[model samples]
Target: MLAQPDARAAAALLALTAAFAAVVALLPWPAGRITLGAAVGAVAGASLLVDLGYPGPYRLPAFWLPFEWLALLGLLFRAVRGLSDRRVGPVGGLLGLAAVLLPLRFSLRTPQGGAAWSVVGVLLSLLPLLGVAGAALYLRVLDARRERAVARARREQRLEVARGLHDFVAHEITGIVLEAQAGQLPDQEPGETAALLRRLEEAGLRALDSMDEMVGALREPGGEGGRDGRSDPPDREERADGATTRRLGLADLPELVTRFGATGAGGTAGVPRATAELAPETAGRLSAEAEATAYAVVLEALTNIRRHAPQATEVTVRVAPGTDGTVELTVTDDGGPSRRPLLRRRPGAGGTGLAGLTARAAAHGGSLTAGPGTPAGWRVSCSLPGR
Candidate 1:
């Protein structure tokens, strides 16, 4: 009752497997043995497929069935593993399917009893195959998840580096630019000019320090995400040389304002002297993320003022608790003309700083806005959620 075998379709694989089996059985030479061993799965799959389709009473030499069945099990395992690779996946899948379905071929020979036997045989074969395939898929899933996690960690590191450059380095560079401008004032005394140069050097040094901190953080394995899988803040990192870098936070606003005010002290007309009105309650209530964002908002505002409104006589930075559980930050400058004509706003090139701060604030459930002040000045305001 065996089904008619498709001799034409199965001929190639049959020949290949027979040739390999013959060499292993007769010659026993190392190369022939190695080749047969290396191709055992393919040989087994081919033998099974041919046997299933072979139109004869006596199957493919009973001696080969035991070896072929064992090898077919191995082939099934390999097929599951190969599914992840695009190159050999199709071939492996086809061969594995043939090998796995070989048991069902029995219904052709045994009439009524064969149907029940074939189903039982297929279910038994499937139990082991499912176990093997499940393990392989589980491992692959873990690997994919790990790759995604590493990619996410690296993206966060890059963002931290960008923020450090923008918040700290840009602030220092802007101060340097302002100091250089103050030195160029026509009636400035030599002593005052020398003092300005010193401040410029200090700002340059601070910018360099910030760059060094960022570079050290990048060089560390796992970056701000510690090797132990703990994610520390970008500001809390140790250098390769054992030096710790301190982050400038809300507490540092007074010093930041003083330095900014000093940058314009030597200028003749409407010299800008920045002031800070930081409320203790707001500072104490804000979370670390909100505090950092608030600090950046102020830093960026001050930097922009130096670039665009250097002649403003009054500049004020205010931080206070807003209605609800939110902290509000405002940096306002008395609208005045730019003394450094060279630093005049290039049309459409501004707002990049504010845009960056806006994104940073929004990431922590906060918002930012910039527009003309009540009477005559530019105003930048940000509201951030608290703890």
Candidate 2:
């Protein structure tokens, strides 16, 4: 059965049409009028049946379709009179008119005679049918236009959310990294440098966690509500109060590596050799955006290794503070050659994985590069502004 229209306006229109059909069926009429009225009522009922949320018989006699014609005319009248605000136009109108008048002509005359009244009926019917058909076609065009508008609006909203995430998270992470770098200078006290690095890691990890939640909301079903609430003073205050203090940063990278290694411990990949080299100060200062970017980059790369380079026995992750104070993350695997390498892999294999990584990196004013490494393995690397 056809799915019922979900829009309130469409449902209301169907209900109104069904009511009109019932009235027409009950009205007094001559014998021929009674027959036509019954037919029209049947057609109306059938149309409304589509809205009852059940599958029914898929076919009806062609002769019975005259009732459908009448229903269409009713729809056209409703459309023109603005009684039904639905945009169904000339195509529906024409079909509806044809359904009514053509059968009337066919019934009035025998095959051979083709009487004058029959001809007149046929011709008169054509006029309304043509008008209604044109209107239906117009309405269809309008529907297409409306659909495009809605889609564009949704796209714009997503981009806006992406932009906000980049600005807030990237900026914060960059600051953290800068402070860590300053502490690394020879003149800075060792204790102070260590403390700064720890704080930076904490802040970056918190941002990363928050970003994951935000991204989840963006991908939420039906796109109801996923926006940056940071503009609200209360929300900002709460953020300042360190809701992210429990976040995981570079300091946690070793744990992440160990966890993955444990998962593969008994498998053919054999303990999944792994390493992490994130500078302590740099790790502490990472921004949320940078951290999130780094996390995603590592996650996707490692996932690709497991899925596509399952034979790889060792994986190495190298994260460092860049000369420009950005965070550079690289995931390299010493597995058998990639079945479908990142750079020149089979079409569909490379598209979704690499494209998502690229978009994530670009969103944070960074870049991601993935390809076959020099020593016959795969490598995924990303560089993002530090916190």
The regions of model 2 sitting more than 4 angstroms off are 1-252, 265-267, 336-350
TM-score of 2: 0.39
Root mean square deviation (Cα) for candidate 2: 16.5
Residue-wise lDDT of candidate 1 within 268-346, one digit each (tens)? 4535767899888875677666777788889898887777666778999998889898888899988565434336455
Q: Which stretches of candidate 1 lie over 4 Å from their true place?
A: 1-92, 102-120, 221-242, 265-270, 338-341, 344-351
Q: Report backbone clashes per prediction.
A: 0, 28
Candidate 2: 10-residue stretch with minimal lDDT: 53-62
- As a whole number from 0 to 100, the lDDT of residue 261 in candidate 1 is 82
Worst 10 residues of 1 by lDDT: 56-65
